[model samples]
Target: MNLPATDRRVLVSGASRGLGRAVAQAFAANGDRVAVHYGSRASDARLTLESLAGEGHVLVGGDVSDPAGAARVADEAGQALGGIDVLVNNAAVNDPHPLATTSYEEWAEQWQRHMSVNLLGTALLSHRAARSMIDRGTGGRIVNVGSRGAFRGEPDYPAYGATKAAVHALGQSLAVSLAPYGIGVASVAPGFIETERVAHRLVGEEGEAIRAQSPFGRVASAQEVAEAVLWLASPAAEWSSGTVLDLNGASYLRT
Candidate 1:
């Protein structure tokens, strides 16, 4: 494992709960300072902050779907952290909007929201962080949290799958463009993770079917995904730029 330098500043977006909070904790566990970003949940964000093991961790809040909001978040985090060394794009929404059952107007709304937040928000943050890294001559890391649904498909959440697919593409493109500046870019596509948000489904009648999707007879945990993100952001993964690591538990194989 390529261990990152001590005291590296990490910015984890949408860290109010679930995988975002887990990722923040992982960074803090490694003695890194973190700037946790949340959308609108101050209470949840505070919990994340309190759960962190180290000092120098701060919280920033904003709607990633808003261009100006995203910029403010980036700036605030950079200033609070004294300069961000690693950016984790973990903020996203998976609103259900099936084309067949939804109205055209609603579909349009969902698509626009997903595209604006998942793709454009992440792109803008990456741009700002990359510029800071380049100007400071500090090689940086960018880890995007994508989803296995991007490849396997989402019948009820078309926008979620589409945005994830776009995110994967964005990571690849940025990896090449930022390579010259010593910046590494990569994405992780996870299968159904057992986050608190999905705890009900995991315990519901569908639980067995979902578990059966993986040969392990279980789904991934929040910590499992967080571990992968930590690895991708490590200095040892410098050569792993442009890679899209999948955490699907062999539920869906790409040929």
Candidate 2:
């Protein structure tokens, strides 16, 4: 089964680093035109764009949480790539807060940030992308990079978990609402991804514990998660919509 996404125009948020960067690279490798979005790091976004194997990879910068910024991304992506065929909302903010020690201010901040970028921003951009697809009169794909925390609560990050749960719901809602227009929406949720940001949180014994919890006996690589993202947006997954695909190595099963 060859997974070729050639000629597809994909907009990937938070592509300056981590899982977003990996996914952007994956799409570029598959010969898709990619618009790589970065929130704050222009240098990093440039680096990611330069590293792509394809010629059409472009860097876009914005705080997607802002409605104007989200719309701008859609416009730039559409213009640069000749209109977006795929939208991957992979931007997120994660800061741990245990309930007992969590402050009200901190909780509010987390919720606001998470909802702004992870939920609202994603929704707005998806809307814009869908409109473009509708105008083209051909079905398109929208893939939300969600977290396993959506299904199972994270003891230290209630706000983050709740927002991710909302992401799942948002994808489902968009799926149903856009079905008539030939647009599909789905989410890919992964657990304990191995990235530089998570390295400090999981090391030595703790890392071992996390590995033991997963059926694969290890945390997932960014490439692994990116592969799943590619699949969800690829023609291979055309029949899948409103689906929450779990790529967690069966670490936390939903019942």
Candidate 3:
């Protein structure tokens, strides 16, 4: 990616590993100061901070599922970064629970957890960061990490898909509301990604079927998604706000 025109203070949530870690590294490489936030992975977050290219990166641990906790985490990051110019909402949890086999209790728990972490967590974090940027009188950006399941639907993980859909909708709403404040909002919807967390599924018997979902015959990589987030948060792409960029390698087309 091209270097940013100016140094930015960036806060990346769920940056302990995978895509979040990559996003943090990209920002650091762009000469941006970063606050890496993780829900319950201090060691992994430390590794991300250590892997960052530049100095002045801090690791923050907090449970974003709680509104107060999310605010606290955002406050700490904003202070450490001397005010944030970018916020990447990437923290989420996905657990499989198909309706055919799931009890009502299990379904209820899944929805609650999914909404808490995926939608509420992101909205609360963005609210805090946006408020900070408004007070600072500096235009900033908020990029949400969304998923293709939001558009295509998920039979086994309905809660995951529903929350992602909400995330995208939330981005568009914020884009309109925060436009005057100069805080652009957007999201990236990606298909199956090649990550350690899902390595077993990718290499399983259904591996070929998964790859065949895309015309490229392969899933996307963490770095690819990170690159997209990096660009969306850049000034040049401010006009792209409210857009949900599809990074699924042509796997699922939305009309």
Model 3: what TM-score? 0.97
Clashing pairs in 2: none
**lDDT pick, better of 1 and 3:** 1
Off-target runs (Cα >4 Å) in candidate 3 are 1-4
Q: lDDT (0-100) at residue 254 of candidate 1?
A: 88
lDDT score for residue 142 of model 3: 94
Top candidate (lDDT)? 1
* Runs off by more than 4 Å, candidate 1: 1-4
lDDT of 1 by residue, 130-224 (tens): 89998888889999999999999999999999999999999999999998888999999999999888888887669999999999999999999
lDDT of each: 0.93, 0.87, 0.92
lDDT value, residue 231 of candidate 2:
86
For model 2, the stretches where C-alpha displacement exceeds 4 angstroms are: 1-4
Q: Alpha carbon lDDT of residue 16, candidate 3?
A: 96
TM-score of each: 0.97, 0.95, 0.97
lDDT of 1 at 247: 99
